[model samples]
Target: MKNSIFNTILVTLSVSLLLLLGGCAKTIVPPTDTSAMATGSDLEYPESHNTGTMGEAGFSEDNLPLEGSLDDNSHSFNDTDIMNMPEAFRREHGRSSEGFLPVYFEFDQFRLSPEMMVVIEQNAAYMQSNPAINLILEGNCDERGTAEYNLALAERRAINVKRYLTNTGIPENHIRTISYGEERPLFLGHDEKAYKYNRRVDFIAE
Candidate 1:
């Protein structure tokens, strides 16, 4: 019994020593791969993504845009881009129309009326203050002309206004053109007064 107890104590000491040694074992990590790999257009591409533009806000995560790129150039945003932008983002929206003038056109034609020089002066003032005002012209026509022809004429009128604005120093990029034709008459009458008012253009913010 004495020999057995001595042997058992020795065995316990050895087991404990083995377990303590194991607790201090060091973990070894393999070296990472470091080779001349390609990148920045040189690397193999996995697959392409189709980025799209937004109808409301221009850009949003829901679009699932590609890694990075311009989606489209269809924004009809004008001076109103500044006005329509949320208050928090108004500062970076584009330009202000504080001193800019509201341009005017002729009575029967879409061309800038000779009397509109004052209106252009006002627009020039507005432009002086706003500096970055984007202009969108929506040409309109009276009910005297046919719908289709009127649409084309209205477009021409808007284009004519834009051309003149550009001649006045406004950048062409800042002005966009569209026509309303005879569809949207300003006055509800067949008289010359109403026709005069209807044959005009409107500015829209994107």
Candidate 2:
């Protein structure tokens, strides 16, 4: 009788152990990706309607707003920020840069292609009409290269675009250049198409 009781107890303990392990297995989770986050920015995905070249990725606080993000209520205000003006700023960079057309770039190259040249000409026309509007020549890259290299490359792209603009009479002071490096990408896919979209510069109004 004692042996019978002992066997039953062992069976019960085994069942309990199996249940515990199963529970633990169900609770286990994979690690999260924190690379997309900027310093002091929220660890989770931010609530953004930004569907620019970055596509669905939110521009963390580290990105700031190129130069032209304005407060929600007004237009062409330099100190105004976009967050305060999310209502329409999402549609256009707003503030100093309303009606500005943001351009995309190819991966790892700083030269504006023939198509990009057309964009630059359009911007030249708008800026010529609106002198107080400062330009933010923001550059971005994909996640393939070293961080430092990507940053330098992005800067170069911005410079390249600025050179074109300068030749077209856009003053040096009118455009400010910034490089986001490989820290931002339009799509998270590891492919040629996504990489191409990421390796470009953005134009913001200040």
User: How do all models score by TM-score?
Assistant: 0.48, 0.52
C-alpha-based local distance difference test score of model 2: 0.56
lDDT string, candidate 2, 61-149, tens digits: 23433332222222234433543555444323322255665555554344455676777788888889988887777666777655655
**Model 1 misplaced regions, further than 4 Å:** 1-108
lDDT measured at residue 160 in model 2 versus the true structure, 0 to 100: 60
lDDT of 2 at 169: 91
Each prediction's whole-model lDDT (CA): 0.49, 0.56
Best by TM-score: 2
- Superposed on all Cα atoms, the candidates' RMSDs to the truth, in angstroms, are 25.5, 13.6
Q: Candidate 1 at residue 37, lDDT?
A: 19
- Report the lDDT tens digits of candidate 1 across residue range 1-206: 99999999999999999999999998532211223111211111121421111122222123322221112232334534545566444322222233333343333333344555445555655665676667666666667545555565566556655655676777778777766667655455898756655666555444
Candidate 2's C-alpha runs over 4 A off are 1-97
